[model samples]
Target: MYTISTKLKVILVLVGALCFSVTVALAQGPGFDEDVEDVPVPFDGGVTFITALAAGYGIKKIREHKEKTK
Candidate 1:
């Protein structure tokens, strides 16, 4: 039988309660919606491709740095 200690149970319950509260707050919060104008900059296929490539390269560099530290 796996018995949970009082201290552990209390910590777990507190964490769960905190998470529930955060979720509820976010659910009721004002945020961007479908009606909002998400007007993207007018970019052709070449520009879009270049932007994606640059972003991917930046992400790859960050991941490599993180891996080296660990």
Candidate 2:
């Protein structure tokens, strides 16, 4: 079972990751979207990878924390 501090840390980490991703995305230069083509392919692989990376990092932290106390 996780202590309150552990839970809080996890939540804060997740929120920070979300904010970082949003800020980086907003800070990027404008892309070339000069076409109204039919069925536009939504390209969000970067976001997906970022999300996965964050999740993996979070899991690693949790596992390490658990191991450290044992």
Candidate 3:
């Protein structure tokens, strides 16, 4: 048997709500009844920026963890 902490229960509920909202919104789709033409999505620099930021954060956290273990 296992017991979940109050904090973890709250976090799980919030995540579940977020996922349900996203699913419902996606199912609703864009409101229009016309023939839509295929539009190409542009490659934005934001993707690269976010990737670099995440990589940097990950590296920093790994270094901190290694130091703490030492």
Candidate 4:
């Protein structure tokens, strides 16, 4: 039983490590041969609004829970 649990733990650790692996590539800018204008990413406003709404909802829920407890 102990060996099985230890093997399960080791498998879980390996799986977790594999799941969270990240690959990133960084470059200074457009190459000297290429000319480009940097354009801002789209839909950021919607994302920001969604994030704020979620945060407000969380805060409201916390406040209600606190009031109920008191």
Q: TM-score for each prediction?
A: 0.39, 0.44, 0.51, 0.45
Candidate 1, lDDT over the whole model:
0.90
Q: Model 1 — TM-score against the truth? A: 0.39
Q: Where does candidate 2 have its weakest 10-residue lDDT segment?
A: 31-40
Candidate 2 accuracy as TM-score: 0.44
lDDT of each: 0.90, 0.93, 0.90, 0.83
Which residue runs does candidate 2 get wrong by more than 4 Å? 33-70
- In candidate 3, position 59 carries an lDDT of 100
Error of 3 at 44 (Å): 1.4
In Å, residue 62's CA in model 4 sits off its true spot by 0.7
Candidate 1 ranges beyond 4 A from true positions: 1-42
Residue 10 alpha-carbon offset, candidate 2, angstroms: 0.4
lDDT of 4 by residue, 1-70 (tens): 9999999999999987766663222324545654667778798688999999999999999999999999
lDDT tens digits by residue: candidate 1, 1-70: 2355877888999999999999989898577887888889876899989999999999999999999999
Model 2 C-alpha lDDT per residue in residues 1-70, reported as the tens digit of each score: 5698899999999999999999999998987688956687787899899999999999999999999999
Which candidate has the top score in lDDT? 2
